[model samples]
Target: MAGKKRSFGRVRKLPSGRYQARYLGADGVDRPAPHTFRTKRDADDWLAERQAELRAGDWSDPDAGKIPFGTYAATWITERGIGASTADLYRSLLRNHLDPTFGTVAVADITSARVRAWRVARLDAGAGPSTVAKSYALLRAVLMTAVDDRLIRRNPCRVKGASSAVTPERPTATVQEVYAIADAIQPRYRALVLLAAFSGLRWGELIGLRRRDLDLTANTLRVRRNIAELHSGKRLIKEPKSAAGKRTVAIPAVILSDLSAHLTVFAEHGADGGVFIGAKGAAPRRNHFNRLWRKACHQAGIKGLHFHDLRHTGNTLAAATGASTRELMTRMGHSTARAALIYQHATAERERLIGNAVSAAVEQARKQAPGPNGHAAGT
Candidate 1:
């Protein structure tokens, strides 16, 4: 007798003595199993599973993610609409870290095991932890987009804690050390250093400032734009990274005269001219300023401090002055409280100083208090 008719697919015996499962997809195209099965029952089982998936509305096209990871990743970067500096960094990360291993791999074939092994290989290859973290984050982000686009069912980047770079606590400069470095630098960059250290302005913000942004009478500087310097020395002027990044920061009274001197001597003539420029009337480049910063650090006897640390120092100093977390966030141009909390943590020393002063005041009050009479107790 003939066997009962099958449901939605057919199992056929191949010439190689294996069974192949084939079915028609929603698009009326013949879809075959990715691989042959050992037995007709196995092929039928596979077909049943596919049918169930379609019935449950959980089916996705198996061939959709056949595109190469590199091609998709490059396209993802381009479509992201990121700034020039960010695009440059992403391209560098992809070229240096990611593309070598998974560039030609199908996006759907990137397994969690493969991702974990890649991370281990990167670490063994002596890639810095920070670089590895950044690469991992970029890879994860790309894969997430692939998932959202239905190119893949799930992202394979499941390595725990692989995205956060473990940066050590950055060293902060003392007030005298800040002054020494400012004084030791070229005269044109003196106010630059002072403003960065006191106002918590980033390198991009300081370089993007114009004469009109500075209100000397109000002692405040408006941060409306940021200039990103690409690896090729191309400068792209753009809006601040976030809305909170565009703010007016009050300059300390001590730095006003230095800023005035800088504006008069080194800044450009018109109101819209750059606030900080080189002696030759060119915009400041990070690479060029790095050399000057290193020399100034050496002359000032300060070591192992980065220019970004100047902003850190300023935030810590602001925290020490009893600024609230919101105030610190606004001053630091940060939208999140995590960075402000870091500066708040640095206020432990200030807490101790306050405690000591309070104890001393209490002691003096006790000493002057009357003891059983109107006379001073210590006297």
Candidate 2:
């Protein structure tokens, strides 16, 4: 019989000094794989170990193990659409920031150092800290899914301090400033501003208001839906952000009267029973309202005021009326007491005035009573 043929496979050196083993199987199929070793002996050992595993039917293709971060991220996003607004934001970030860097990198190769470098690059590219943090969060979430899928051993994004520090932008406005802005606005938008300032409604919530949502007799406004401007040149009506957001707020008597007057005068002829329609009775766009708001502010000589500030103004005024924190949270649909405190802080001056009144009352009582004596009458 002829001697058994040698079964040694061809070996090639990689640019990284690692050797790749290429071999023809008994079935005449060719396979190529990385040995992940520097020395020839180590490579040979790895190859022998892998061949034995193949013989034992326990071999796993190492190349097939590595999944590109971009591919995994896309799959995760498709599987879980976080929310319409959040998904849009994530898509923008992936297209503009993440895909460019880690799109081709293997999910398993994504180390904490690599992630930190990416964050540094983002900051070097003049991205804000908050933008960088959000990007990191998105990447981290994708990698976490990889861990769950057994594609990666660990998520590098979970490293402490991997996310950049971001300063939160202030989101509050004073009541006086909002009123001054409303007073200077054109008559068409005046009621709109008043409605926002008094109702604590979001921009979408205000624009989505139908005539039926308001009850003048009952002095209540039910917030059932919100209208958003989509990329499709038309409005999309969506449910409110939370269950608490779909609440019925008691309209102040003043706001009810204004709404009754506005309906009879301006919005009565609009289609769709809209309470605040644009010119020619079209569904109002947020941009149109924002532009009008800005122009009104400019004319009113008010600075640093935004249209959303009207909601803040409403919260501040409500807090000044001695509304408890719970009441304020309920009215504003704030999921946490921390958010309600922002509005309460805007009324800090009112708190100081109350403090002064209490101090004066204490001083009066002290003066009217005997000092250091148990006297029944004034000394």
Question: What lDDT does the true structure give each of the candidates?
Answer: 0.91, 0.75
Candidate 1 deviation (Cα RMSD):
3.9
Cα lDDT over the full model 1: 0.91
Q: Candidate 2's C-alpha lDDT?
A: 0.75
Q: Please list the Cα RMSD from the true structure of every candidate, rounded to 1 decimal place.
A: 3.9, 5.9
* Candidate 2 local lDDT, 1-379, one digit each (tens): 2212336665666677766666655445676654356766675676677578678855444444388888878878878957676666777788788999999998888898898788889899998888888888889888877777656656787557656574765456555666677678766666788888887888888888888888889988888888877544456788887887888887878767667878887774534588877776777777677787788889877877778877877877888887888898888876678877776763567878899999997777677756576752354
Pairs clashing within candidate 1? none
* lDDT at 138, model 1: 99
Residue 232, candidate 1: Cα error in Å is 3.5
